[model samples]
Target: MVAITGSSSYNPIITINTTTTINEKLTPATFPQWRAQFEALLIGYDLIDFVTSKHQCLAIDGTKSATSKAVNFYWIRQDKLILHAILVSISTTITSFLTSCKTSHEAWAALTCLYKGKYRTRTMQLKEDLTLSTRSSRSVIEFLQAMKIIAYELAIIDHPISDDDLILYILNGLGPEFRDIAAPIRAKETSLKFEEIHDLLVGHENYIRRMENQLASNLITTVNYSHWKGGISSNDRSFSNMGHRHNKQAIHPKATPSSIQMNLQQIVQPPHKEKIKNGLLTLLHRTR
Candidate 1:
């Protein structure tokens, strides 16, 4: 196992490739090696513009004999993973909620927050906090609850959590003072968590709300109008349709006073040609 450290103190404790179980092969800019490179880069706190590759972690093919347990992709998922959590924040929507930073005071304050940073992506596991343990928990609810419990402790309530149901409902969340709080503490925790979660989430929902006023701002998302309007192909089709109609008036003379008085100059125009043009024009209009 190896360790990577940031140049400065502000960075989170990010550990990478801290294991000898590096089973896969490494490529210069390819899979396992690429991620190893990224781990190395993190040591200096340098921002990488793009991810170069994916690494392998497990192999599941029907390879050599008795047992078969494998994972094909080897990436930083283990390090990035916040997996194996027991409890977490409960929320209604994905994009609509804002999870707060995991802090030391959350458990004491009867509040909960997101364990990972906003820019981070992670997965969660569940716990036996009775409030959510027995009900039909959807994926989102289970996940939120697990994340909350991990970051903060919950106050224990007076309600009897029998020995048999200990596996089902938690007497208190995992933390230092969790076992001591009373049942009424549950209400306070629930209220604070709900309200703070709602408020923090609302902030994310309203992030830069009045976008209409930021037209000239550097952060504005601008798309080229000309690109959206399409190009010569679209314009040519429209012009071709109008051109067909315009040619008729240009070639055939109108029955105005001056037009009617004008001499033929040489040979008389063919009445059949004029009738043919007019007939074709009428046919086109009818078809349309």
Candidate 2:
């Protein structure tokens, strides 16, 4: 492998061409994903040695022939190409890790040591984050996605969280509103997948929202109905009271309709006429 890489005829373009565009750059949280992509790219180009420290740069010495200088030049070029690829894949914030590394092997070594050796610390932190996560005002999907990301981080560190434990963590964080479903999930004898639980929680969330809307609608309807009924009752009471007062005044004996009509007749008829009429009726009776 060293002889082949050191040959003047060997091209480094093969390694450059094999470079897969890493969509997700390296970050503390994404180390595992970044490393997998980078490693695969190196492996595909048969240039894994450049990063693995397997390919040593040919020595350029005063005693060496012109052929040796050609080998050294090509070797250095390939190594630098690999190193540049690594630098570009990493995020700017974390470039400090490779600041002192001059070659591909050094850069790769620095990153591996920093991430793999320090996994324990990151793993513990992620576990804590997962444990303390809550649904809060976020939707069920958002909440679950956050927890799942933590789980994935833990898995990358080889400290995978079991489904049961993960479910328990999720239930604990969902607050009392989801206790109905959470309790049932806890008591189940069969194991459930994360996807299944996610669906169930989302469905329950929708149901809760629907119920709240229904309750609000019902309350508004009840308030409007009561207000209408109260207005009608108030108007009816006012009219009834007014009619009762008028009837009471009109029916009093001193102010009755019959008394008014009799008074009117007494004023209109003359006293002499009534006496003359009565006398004539008596005389007629005597003749008969």
Candidate 3:
């Protein structure tokens, strides 16, 4: 009987496990996003220790005893298990490179080396992106979010940016709309935190929106007033035209049969004869 004693019940001496399935797996595309989480998982499973080093199972002086052989076999089995777990997390394309690695340590180092180069290149690209970032037509919030993402990626790679530099970059990238706020923040003797700058810029943006709304309201009021005035002017022109027509009718009254009939009736009426004679006399005087 093989005697097994260890602190944990699931120790390799007590139990050699079956297939290990991790909830979170790694792929080439997700390597950057999931690398930290995957590493944490590895640590949780106690498999990181195996990858970090090969466990010494025998005496240094090349001793070949039953105890040493059992210990070596235990180490080998554990290494294989850890290696299988890592391989399961990786994708087929990258898995090919790690297939030849006999020990877990070798596989881990190979993956690290491969990803580290890519990480450095990615870091450089992110740094360049941050340097060239601009607000342009983007909203203040949108611009800040983009810059912060680049900064975050750089920080993850151990190339952290200072808040002062970040503030300066933000100030530089801002469009003309934010100039008033950015100028004051830049003129300050002490460096302002990014949060302070963000608050000021956001406040200014809100003020701008309010002012825009007020201007629009004023414009609408002016347009409506102009339209009302135009309607009144149009009505006045219509009345003026009607008055002109009445004056023309007074100056050049049409000689119709009704006028002749009215004249005959007035001539026959003794009561209208005096008034008709007075009207004729006035007309003759005015014509002269």
Stretches of candidate 1 exceeding 4 Å from the true structure: 1-194, 208-224, 228-288
> Which stretches of model 2 miss by more than 4 angstroms?
1-13, 17-20, 24-33, 40-84, 91-106, 231-288
Model 1 lDDT tens row, 1-288: 334443232233334342232333222112223234333444344322112212223345666422323122212232232110101211223212223423212221222132223112221222233444422332323433554443332211112323323321432322332233324344452233333443443343344233423422211111112223443244333433443343433212222322222321111236334543344344334333
- In model 3, residue pairs whose N, Cα or C atoms come closer than 3 Å (at least 3 residues apart or on different chains), thus clashing, are none
- Considering lDDT, where higher is better, how would the candidates rank from best to worst? 2, 3, 1
Better of 1 and 3 by TM-score: 3
How far is 202's C-alpha from truth in model 3 (Å)? 2.8
lDDT of 3 by residue, 154-189 (tens): 776667899888888888888677777777787789
Q: What is each predicted model's overall lDDT from 0 to 1? A: 0.30, 0.71, 0.63
Model 1 residue 176 lDDT score: 30
lDDT score for candidate 3 against the true structure = 0.63
Q: Go through the candidates in order and give the C-alpha RMSD of each one to the true structure.
A: 28.7, 25.2, 22.1
Which candidate comes out best when scored by lDDT?
2
Each candidate structure's TM-score, on Cα atoms with residue i matched to residue i, is 0.14, 0.57, 0.60
